[model samples]
Target chain A: MSSLGMADKVAIALVLLALAGQLFFQSARRRAPYSKLRKVNAYQSADLLISAVAEKGRRLVLGIGNNLTDQGASLSGVAGLPLLKAISRRSLFNDQKLQTVSGDGVLACLSQMVTHGAYQNAVAVELFQPGEAVLAGTTRFASLAGLLPEVNHRANGGVILSGQFEGETLLALDLAARKNILVAGSTASLGGQAAFLAGVCNLALGEDYYAPAASLETDPAAAASLRAQDLLRIIIAIALLVGAGLTIAGVL
Target chain B: MKKGLPIAVAILSGLFVLAGLIFQPYLGPYLGLVLNWAVIVGSMALLVAIASLIIYHARSILTARKGFIFSIVILASFGLSLVGGLWLGVDNPAYLKWVGAIQRPLEVSLLGLVALIMTSAAVQVFRNRGWSPLTVSFGLSAIFFLLIALGLLQTLEVPQIATVIGYIRQLPLVGARGLLIGVAIGAVMMAIRVLLGSERPYSD
Candidate 1:
């Protein structure tokens, strides 16, 4: 304990609790529990986009904004990776295609890898198009600007804006809305959540709420991760309530 | 070994960084070096990414794809900017101006678009609401914010109205700050998962 601060110990304890929770849920299969994650229409819209692409042979556009690195809040992009895996697998299964644009080159590269793996896992590696993931400049507007015109071309099925979006979110959301394309956005950026609430048809709001992949239960690993996240969230919420109550009682 | 080595490396490096950040011991030097290495590795990844990008666009141009013109433009811009940056150096005023010429207009256009979208969204706010209590609350709050933004509320000659707007604006601020904490929690959760090898984007 001397090797780390008190706060670090708290963080370690919490992570262990999360790991424990994940294990508990996975082990107790007969007594299944449900996560209290609210209904996010973005998951439905994502599912719809896959079905639409299959049914109509239309293209799906994926916008993973400027957040790509493994550092800091960029994990929001990583958090949304399961959706990409799911969509890529579905597209491969249905013999449809999807295009991805990213503000970060690293993200585009990783996304390509993810898509390739998804196709390979689905046993349709030949249909995997390596060129679908494009790095549309690092600048916020530059990325959106380059992708806006591309959407006009490939947008027939739908578009899902995921990852980290900030001030330039409205442009992408608004442009997608203008095209009358079925659009949904998922991100941890408060700006993204607000923009989606205002313009996009569906949304996954807070980073805490990116539990879409948990519902699918296709990947046990992802389910376990979601269980951990939900457990942590409940703990935090309870702590907040307790703190608030204690403060009211002049004991905080 | 392939998977095990990567996950093992990730967890050790992650722990080192975390411990250094918290403890500030001799391990801090190693943590700093690891971070520097991370940045160096990230920079190298950019080169690979660009090579892949160039290949993709080149194929489109070569195959005469429908958007091949855009591909040409992309390649040309990339080539020119790279050459100019090398020739003039990134810090040169001329190089900066050259890049800004490409950046400024796009930024302006996007901001203008956002403003238009915000206006349109506000105008059509109740179109789908069907007069539910929730819709009414949302619509009223939006209008209240809009009135404050437009200086319409200040025109009422009531000082107390300004106070109300001030308090109202802070509501979103407080909510945003709360969301920031939520974002931090989510980030920590994700980082821990990555470190534990429970969430491996790199692993197939």
Candidate 2:
């Protein structure tokens, strides 16, 4: 700690602060549930689409974006897991297909495990298939190409994309829109967010990308994490405002 | 114990890594070892993923599914790439060029298609979002940025115009920074959740 630079120290302080917030919220929720997560249009749309697809005997697709490895934007990739499990659990007994696709090998494997676990929890192990989760392509464009066919054929109900992706994913969103299938997406990348804003999807932007699990009320810890995120967001916003004011006042 | 073991391992390792990052001078070697182990495990997982992919395509071909022909094509391409990579060594220039010749154009063409889709999507944004304040602001900002990006404003070269353009560019930076802070906070909270065993995204 003595050898660490100023920036490193600040980063450490921030992490510790957030960690403290998380622990506090986690214990608080265990005592009494936190139920005040703000509404998210994307999750609502997903629920409606799932019901529609289940009724129509069609399928739904979840694109667990490509940036899942250590070398890429992995946090946002891992962030999609809770949503994957939630979707799999929700769609389990309905006889409607739920397929997941990813460009990264590790992410695809994790998705397969989570999906299979969902089946296990539902007591429907016989219905689970290995092909339900797929490694579409190792590269971004190839993965998009691999996913388009599934979107074309199976996504009769809707497509929900929740992961770290780039601008190319808008092409998939566009394709889904053309087919009149319900589309919803979220990404932590700026370009991807812009693309989603332009496309016809119920979109979750910025911190909302991390709120799906909490919004669904599936896991108490997720709700706690969202609270921690909000606490830190408020802290950072106040700091930014103060800094701007100081600069405007000619105080360094 | 099956679940508890993974959670414990995750928590301890996460703590150790965090400590190592903070106190790097003392625990650098241990940090390297842990990261190397992670790399090894990740590589093995990749192998398993590839094997599963091959098996999936094989089953499709065996069952003569609707797109069985594409399965055959995928498998053939996989085979060719694997054999070529093994025989010629992946770093060989000829092998790299051989792969790149096919990969580069396909990726570029896909990107071109994405640009076209983006243009169409931009047009549809108005229709889909209607005349709401958010959509109106988005439309106006986008058109403003597009004109700036095309150098139409730059061509005028007036001092006041350039100053206003500079301020406009800084406006996006402010919004971008706000978004970045939110994303960073969310990511840190998620990591903390994993460390505390409140979330088990890696649980099988």
Q: Candidate 2 has what TM-score?
A: 0.96
CAPRI-wise, candidate 2 is medium
Model 2, position B137, has a per-residue lDDT of 87
Cα-based RMSD of candidate 1: 3.1
Every prediction: chain A TM-score: 0.86, 0.94
Q: Write the per-residue lDDT of candidate 1 for residues A1-252, one digit (tens) a residue.
A: 466666778777886776676666556642344444333467766777768767887788888777766435256766656677767766765544688888776777778888888777777779777777777776677677667876787535688877887755776666667777788777788877777667755776565445556554445545555666666777888988998999999997
Candidate with top TM-score is: 2
Kindly list the per-residue Cα lDDT of model 2 for residues B67-121, writing each as its tens digit. 9999999999999999999999999999999999999998999899988998888
- Cα error, residue A129 of model 1, in Å, equals 2.7
- Candidate 2 reaches a DockQ of 0.77
